[model samples]
Target: MLFVTIDRKSSVSLTQQIYDQIRKSILNRDLEEGERLASSRGLSAAIGVSRNVVLEAYERLIAEGYLEVRSKSGTFVAKGSFLPAKGKTSEYEKVMPNVADRKPIIDFRGSHPAMDQFPRKKWGQLTRDICYEAPDHIFGYAEPGGIRELRVTLAKYLQRVRSVHCHPEQIMITTGATQALRLITEMLIKARTGISVEDPVTDEMRNIFFSAGAGIIPVPVDENGIIPECLPKEEGTGFVFVIPSHQFPMGGILSIQRRVQLIQYARELNNYIVEDDYDSEFTYEGAPVPSIQGLDPERVIYVGTFSKILSPALRMGFVVLPTHLIETFRRLKWFHDRHTSSIDQLVLSRFIEEGYLDRHIRKMRRIYRKRREVLETAVRASFKNAKIIGRAAGMHLVVDIPDIDFDDALAGEIEKQGVRIYPVEHFAMNKGRHTHQVVMGYGSLTPEQILQGVTQLKKFLSTRG
Candidate 1:
């Protein structure tokens, strides 16, 4: 006999609950096609409900095609029924469209990681271990600054790899780098200040500061990153958001001299700098650049993310705040979101402490290097006229296609050829300047896909001309 429990306290009536459960079973194939259900009297006795209630529930299920009543036989599931697979929707869909149906043949879009390479098996094992071993308190609401163990582990990891100067007390776990930036934009960088941003910067980063009520001051970037000499000398500049390890869209590292120059300018102006070290772990050109935070820990708020190293769906990122900003940042996070998931933080703590995070990053570094090399070689072979920049370190590099307009129309036409690529100017606030450049991100693509995407790109460029 199938078991069915009734919630007497629920607002839902017993008849409706019975109907719902039966219908759900039919659709889920738990009651397969032609599987007979219990008779009304039997169901009523089993559920301790009136026979009339069971009759009504069966009648409803039968009327909906979830159950079919035979002439002499009792109820049975219909031959065909509807069931939504997984029935899940992403929070990102609220901001973007439902593009699942029309996935691009080869996506060259930026800011993605090699998701296929993620160690989901090891992560699953670690998660299960934490679920059984962690204290009961870890399942409840936690400190807005994140679980202490994760923060401690992150502090040690950042210091070892990025050369960031930070104590565990100053680290706050966030959903990702965006949340970290959003907090800094709203709290430390109020609307009254000028936000010095890189020209041809990503739209998402630009929007964060703009939404926080700050005016953007565009600083020009070259192969070496934001020109420190170009930084505004005017007062009221509160913060500078930079991806110095490997810039976005442009993909360049800030030189040591420029790092010093920018730090000195911030010191003189009494401002803050938010260093988004989002992809420093994938650096292939020798040792990665030491973080600017190491240069001036008191002035730089170092932010990093597992989205690139682990999985984007994990939504785990952290910021190492300056001593003066730690309290204020934590308070702001409390008001915004009490905290990130405590269980996730706990599991991540164990993952890092057990050396999985380090091992995984090391493995990915090699994989990403191979992907980058494949992309670089394919692009060079296919587009001889184009120039590649910012290949020193990062998941992506810029391909400058001179003497042509890489505008929206060109992009649309390229898409019509079944190749999805974005012009670098598409991400820039100062758009016209980078019109000839396009960003090719290889992190999320396989070597075959990388070659295929560039081949399609070459076809369109050659034929279009």
Candidate 2:
């Protein structure tokens, strides 16, 4: 029965102060569950406060489920009243380092594009041209599917390069793949669909699917990507979302046979397949892998985005729905936000038409390849136990840092020395196999920065010894 005195001159009211003090004591275990509270008059006299203040404070505690009162038995700590301190502070605190304690560091956050290489001059010119030539109708609410020109361009671009089959009318442009996913889940998914996702996949997508109330089932990925055999033998599976071309955070491309198996499995379950061609444009290996959407357009929904090739700030991504779902997606897009920005769509159409997007991706592929090489070489030189994966394509790679927990505390120490790496464990939902690995992004980092950041990372690890 700890009582705190409150000053009337203070900004906070006396009742609030009393309520907070009592709550803290309860949380700290000084006041245990089912303990009787002091009478309001007694508490007021003991703490030099009015009975009204004590009553108000106790009422608040009662309303908050921390206390209970009976008609004549008086107030007592509620049943199951034990309170626990918010525990996530320890998790976040383990990673908190004084920014001034470290030098300027390079970052390796995944999904980041190299903004330093974007053609700003050309983009500004095109934006100006679109605005100058814009008609009044262009500014009004257009089709929620997307601007006809951008959709047509995407349709052609995907078919020619990636082998995705779809017409312009079937394409639905979204803010990004995240929104594209949200809109699809909202429209197509009702109650729990057995949503199958790759193990060691992007945490963002997992969260989105889970938040939509889809029961997520983790399917393992081997050297050839998400193993089709691992999918649950369930009847109600609505879809399987895959990043078959350079799987996110890990660079495994699905073999042609596995891709066929996946399509066949989807057909058997009567489930749709979502092919996220996320960063397929920059694959440096043998001719870029053909999109799985080409195998069975009726069962595959092809999602493509300009975020990796251009910049995320552009917020341009699209989904090429099969014929059956096209109208449903259009209605979903219409109700979601009317449509994506008309101005940005117009500018992107010109960017693609004039060959800047293609040229930019070509140049970036070379630069990123060299950067990836630099990172791999440095990791081998600095750390004896680190095993690198997914270097054949994409802007990032996964490094298995053996003999270290690679948890939040270790991540903080590396960050303190001015090097950044993402914990692969944070991305796991059902806790996949890669607990000791961290995903490293090389897209935005320069060759020099990669070398320096790796050196700092080694120094940080040596201290752990």
Candidate 3:
């Protein structure tokens, strides 16, 4: 007879509880192979439960090969069901450090948009409308490049907003900019050739290329983005990856002179220029700069995403490939995941066609601009010597506090004081140059949170000083 106990108050069903205990006993070898189990009726009475519960449990166990039923005989433990228990502590658990349970009161990490402001109601309505009225073929596997409607809409929108020159047929939709980068890496990076990227770039960007078994030639960056003059003169370079619209961490706009130089260098090397037009939608100051791809579409591969504009949860982005790379990219994208969500692509197409995307960008620009102002004001007031770097664009600004090395230890200490800040040094490939600076993002924080978080940061720094 098997002894089983059931807690009537547990959220788990009685059937599951009975099934779990019997399975555990069999795996632990408490019930040896060929050992007979009590009849469903007898076990039901013994455990004071309905006979149906036991029968269901037994059926599940038998179906899973844990218990077998012989003709005219009772249920018996399966011959090969025994599995010895391993030690509780795993090898991974033994080596890895424990993560802290407490979350920072205010996190200043960049690249996150205001998720709370996501137009959920409108999005939901659009989704519902798309599902109801969209043709049945949309539910099936779509073109590996993307749906025709979305690519067409994006071609016009990119041309209008960012001055990108592209045909709808050349556009390939990706899960996000990350996927676009991965696919591009696969297509471009050869065994001998490597990529030339901005030094002090986002760590994620560096990791993507590095993980792809491609070498990275670190080109130094300044307040005006990648120094084109310092670009490697070698012939073994595959492509130059740059966030021209707004550089990460340092937050610089690549100057036109530098942009032209970058294009010429790529042409000289006979390589492509991977231009990541990240967060170009919200510029607080002068007119938005035109994309480098517009200057030389043949040599420049343009990558754009809706993650920063709307919500990262959407996982929607696109890449404009040069004419020659389109077919190869399509094959690569097909093998990667066949395609991104078709209904999502349709919904986004409608969103752009209906002009909701433009309106949302305008609204978020105002909100984010106000938050940026609040952050700048608070930081200036709190720390008189703090110098804000970068162009007056994007969601983040770099704060240069002289005489302070914003390394991991100091950042960790500040986190303990209920605030979190990212050190620019952490993003650097060459290190030590940006030890005095930190990147503070106001995209996800409200004006109130920005003000309070900066105040707390200043207070913590004062105590440390």
Candidate 4:
């Protein structure tokens, strides 16, 4: 005999309720295989449901193989109906590792924009306006290369601001620079070909290449960016990856002389150059440097993103490929994700066309410059032996503190003090060389937070002495 209950007040139909109960019981093995079940007429009376409701429930269970009818006899639990049970979900969760709640800290880990300062009102209005004004086709699947309006606007914007020479047809929009790098790596990395990258490159970029099964040839970087002469002269090199405008962690701008040498080297080797012009617009000392792509657009793949200038949440970035690689990239992009969000692309196009992007960058440049100044001042005042490395550009600066090895142990101790700082060695492909340096980011921090973070760092370091 099976004991079943029915709820008269439930929105679920009586027939469905009965069907679900029996199915669940069989699956749970509470109603064992080959066990005889009561007749529909008897169950209706026992559960206070109509006989027809019970009949329908049993019929569904029979059709689903949970119950079977034996000619003259009543329904019985089907053979092979028993499923081995996994342990309770709660039991499994009890053994899962627990991640502690993140505490508020003065985070100096850079590459983040001031998200609070995002022009939400203007962006919201643009999104609404674009949705209403755009054609119905705007919501459909976009071209793999991206919508035409955005590519055109970005082409003009890049040409004017960064001196990148490219036609709109060559631009490919991606989820972010990260994706752009991934796709490019996938398309370029052949068997026995390796990527030549800066030594102390961002760990994220290094990992992207590593994930693609491409070998990494680390060219040592200094205060003047990647040493052109140090780059591998072999022919198996696929391309040279660089952050010339503002080298990450080290913060060096590649000189025009080295830029030309890099282009000549690529030309000689028949390989290409991948220029990542991230956060180059926030220069505090002088005008932004012209992109190396402009020097030899045919040999350089220029990648840029709005994450550093706008917000990472946008996940908007583009890559300018050589004319020869455009078709292949489009095919790769089409199969990758079928293209980025079409409506977002359209809204971003209008934002750039109407000069909102330029205005926003200009506003952010001033804010980041002031924050960088605060960080520089605080570090100088707090650490008497600290020497700032790199140019006075980008959101983060590297400070060389002699005799201090900012290893994992020291970094963890600093974090315990309610502050977070990134060690330069953390980003190094060749370790131990940058142990005395730390990268300090102030883009997302206020003046007070920067000062307090520096003070905390000073106190923590003094205790170790």
Report clashes for each candidate as comma-separated counts.
0, 0, 0, 0
Candidate 3 minimal-lDDT segment of 10 residues:
96-105
lDDT of 4 by residue, 44-149 (tens): 9988878999999999999989999999887999999878797567866877755685667899977788988998999999999988899999888889889999
The sequence of per-residue lDDT tens digits that candidate 1 reaches over residues 1-465 is 245789989999999999888877766767678887889998898879999999998888878778788899877878877475665666776678557756567888786898888888988888898899989988888899998898888888888989998889999999888898888888865634688998878888888888888888988899999998878887788788788999987888899999998889889988888888988888887888899999999989888998988888999889998898889999999998899998888888888888988898888888888988998889888877878888556678888878668888898888877787888878777657888888888889999998889888888788766
Question: Candidate 3, residues 1-465: lDDT per residue as tens digits?
Answer: 478999999999999999999998988888999999999999999989999999999999999999899999978998899997786989898887667855647989797899999999999999999999999999998999999999999999999999999999989999999999999998998645589999998999988998888999999999889998888887888899999988997889999989989888888889989999879999999889999999999999999999999989999989999999999999999999999999999999999999999999999989988999999999889888899999888889999999788999999898888888999989998988999999999999988889889988888888875
The best candidate by TM-score is: 3
Of candidates 4 and 1, the better by lDDT: 4
TM-score result, candidate 2:
0.77
Candidate lDDT values, in order: 0.85, 0.85, 0.92, 0.91
TM-score of 4: 0.83
Sorting all predicted structures by lDDT, with the top scorer first, yields 3, 4, 2, 1
Native RMSD of candidate 2 (Å): 10.1
Prediction 3 global C-alpha lDDT = 0.92
Residue 418, model 4, lDDT: 87
The better candidate by TM-score, 3 or 4, is: 3
